[model samples]
Target: MTACDQARELQRIIDQQLISTMFQPIVDCQKGTVLGYEVLSRGPSDSPLHGAPALFQAGEQCKQVISLEQACLLEAGQSCIRHGVSHLVFVNVSPGLLLPKAFAEDRLQSLLATNGLKPENVVIELSERYPADNPEALKARLTALKKRGFRIAIDDLGTGYSGLKLWSEIQPDFVKIDRHFIRDVDRDLVKKEFVRSVINLCERLGCRLIAEGVETVAELTLLRSMGIHLIQGFLLGRPNPFPTAELSALDNPDPIGGGQATSDAGYLGRYIVPLAPTASLGEAWQVLQSSPSIFALPVVDNDRPLGLLHKWRVMEVFSSTYGRALNETKPVSSLTAYDALVVEHDESLEAVSQSLLEDDLHYLKQHFIVTRNGHYIGLGSTRSLLRMMTRSRVEQARHANPLTQLPGNVLIQQEAVHRLQQNNPFTCIYFDIDHFKPFNDLLGYSKGDEVILSLARQLCTVFNGDSEWVGHIGGDDFVVFSDRLEIRKRCEEVQQLFALEAATRYPEAIRQAGFITGEDRDGLPRQFPLVALSAGIVVADSRAFGSAADLAATAAVAKSKAKKAVSGIQIVSNIAALNEMSDDHKTTLLA
Candidate 1:
């Protein structure tokens, strides 16, 4: 058959949109909620008349393939709007197909706006298994898209020629974790570290990191432990033709943040409350009155969380030298739960409750702290565990997004200040979601959240609580304290891991891999330009500063250096760096 003759026949099917668009729901693996869907082009049945390959194979190569991609994007965009797609809608394309001048930005915008979508709501993915397309063309289009509120991603990285070239070429907002690194992530340190580096880079450069092909609970647990706040995998939800669940509605539609939200679909399980050891005798009494089973209230001041009045500890206090004044005595750590354990709020209630049950009988601590990141939310006691577990379910049903479960800012500041007062070594990691706002704007908050949660999970693993405490300071910013010695190394680890994860999770770079871009901030042509990351590492040590404010300022300075230095970790090891940057100008300018 003649090419044109065959093209006419293929065009009939392409025009019909017969190719059933397959969907893979992106989920917050840590929270077990659907966050978004990736649109995949599939064929109806097995016939050549219905297959994407068949249509393209029949003289539909360049023009037809490009047309088909546009069609799929338009369709997916419509689906997101009609279904209130809370999560991102990922649409895949190939560089070979997309780099053509035909893939115009203005035309695409018009099509999307027609479907109630903007450049911000879609994450354009590359379907190929290699790096980059025409360097100049991809950059030209992607930059234009970004300016218009669109975000770019590199899909299925680590499976092909995904390398530094691709990454430097197209600084994508989201990096899809190829199944290779995701499989057995819980068991593989290499994989864990690899993904962590990507997240680190994401945090530094304002990019979003996402893991693809996640299929196991262990993987989910590992990611959650690493501090990843979002995820996607079969363990959470499967994709459907339509958006089937509510995963958002929790994001601040307005500029402000934080509010009480709950859900009925899942239980919050029981969140633990930390009692101040020296809670004025009156406060302790009040807490006990509100909760009779509160055998102890955490005694917390500016230092670490301390214990409350243990049944036996209380008796011991009365029998001591000052037995008569025991009731009014200064709160002591004696009543505290030694080695108090913590579970993230996004975790499964069943597993956490079971753990509590197993340890309750022989428990040294009477409460469990329910936390998101590392900030405390509330206290979960043995008595309230049951009731609160049910209540948690209501919270989950009421609110769709599980990525954010912590109470909010007031608690975040308390946690930060508390760590500072402890005088222990801590690592302050000022995490910025490389291009998170743009990515979120492009893919939707749900998918953006998936990236956030994923990074949180990665950091938790790398920054696991030591004397080194890790906590979310809000938004994309996070901190970690490792008792002095390891604090510096830990910060470096976060930096490296972030870059690697960003490479893997974003497909735009992978598809744009071997290409090069020459552009300035103004979009004018330039020389060998590309996008990457900048991270600042500040170690919480005596030489650096004594207060949280000082530590934060030093850290912020170091972070600026990292961002400006291109690659490599910058540690504020001395007062000189801090000294050189004082407000009063005690130092002379180097002429």
Candidate 2:
């Protein structure tokens, strides 16, 4: 069709309000919950302008792009209201719609208000495909929109040079990585690295990332490991007129890959909120004003935190003679509190707090800067640091088993409960030494304790990570938990290693015979098989169980079966029937 024909058709469609809106969920991959939905526009199903690309292309051609954009915005708003969507609704806005002539700054706010929505509930997603002639002016307009409470997102990131430039300039609250890079990301290490870098960059900028066009579980799982929690695409949920979150996509939980949790359970990223190194003191002042309770702000350039800006220091300067005029326009780095502590996100909170307490940098202790990969994220307060340190010490002392120096059942239960509440899928393995009592009786309690310590050391070697946990439930009974896909394989490896150690720990006679002479419980002489490890594993499904007690119960039943099998792994899952390990028991080294 000619531009004239297309324009006429577009006009007719607009006058009749023939556009349709669909929603696709952007899920929180970590929590297995819906974060929000991105509003997608479609023309009449049978029309030539059906898809957003075609519809908007025709609008651009007919010089009616602004009109089409407005229609989409209104339709999206109404649809969200009709569906009673309380979560954030992401709406696509053309740069043309931001023009002084075509754009009304309050248009969206008014439309959302009519639909019982607020500006905060809407995220304006602008594609880089359309470049504005004056980037600075466009940013200014977006800044105005931000002040009015709307969140901005750069859509299809990495698809255009302008997008990258816009990202650096605007520092959007969210960035949607284009599907091209996300496609088959799991299989492509380069893509994974690229995405990982973006995830890290987002963290530094304090921006949340949404991986768009995720089409496979592999891609989804890979993104989750990289700390990209917000996700979108067909793999998560297809866009539909009446959309619902496809939480089932999160059933396959993968191990979180950052690193081990430090003492005091704190990381620097949790405490950092950074300002650009070039940002003026006035800008820093505004930041402090907005977050009235914040004490300090980190000044950073390219992910590297240069120094901190304390609220009191800023106030002191502004209150001084001509101080406001002297510093308001100067770079935040000029007046930053260099004495404030700077620490990496992975650093032990305990060590950081100790360092701070020893320094005596300031009389009024407040907050410290936190960095991940050298980029500033936010500030951590002294109060939080002290509280976390005290809690960690108390919990460690109270829950550690004195015998093995490992966490006791209480810690294990607490860990299980926390994972359950997060709906994080994992495997729980209950391990008990087969014929342990006979060996303990033969060797005596002190020797038995030595064997137990050896086992504990073996466990520590296998499950030494933040995502994996090990606990001594007492005596020969132990529990292991992991949210990794390789949990089963890891369990088998542990068993093999344990079997070898078990054979070695016994006397030469017992090793050669593969059995030891011991008196049965009734005081009858009998030959007992050499010690072996039995593991009963309960795999958590996507949906959490009733409680940690439910998980323990399930694991207990599986353990019974495993023990009956003599020396092998037994697996059960809440979502499926009981599953037993393959008949191929490891090498039959013992019994």
**Top candidate by lDDT:** 2
Which candidate leads the pack in TM-score? 2
Model 2, 176: alpha-carbon shift in Å? Answer: 1.0
Candidate 2 whole-model C-alpha lDDT, 0 to 1: 0.76
Against the hidden reference, what TM-scores do the models get?
A: 0.39, 0.45
By TM-score, how accurate is candidate 2? 0.45
Which digits, one per residue and each the tens of the lDDT, describe model 1 over residues 218-251?
4654566566756666655566566553344222
Candidate 2 regions exceeding 4 Å error are: 1-4, 255-591
Per-residue lDDT for 177-268 in model 2, tens only? 99999986654434665787788788888889999999765567667756888999897899989869778768743212111322322332
TM-score of candidate 1 on Cα atoms, chains taken together: 0.39
Backbone clashes, each candidate: 96, 9
Please give the range of 10 consecutive residues that has the lowest summed lDDT in model 1.
Answer: 256-265
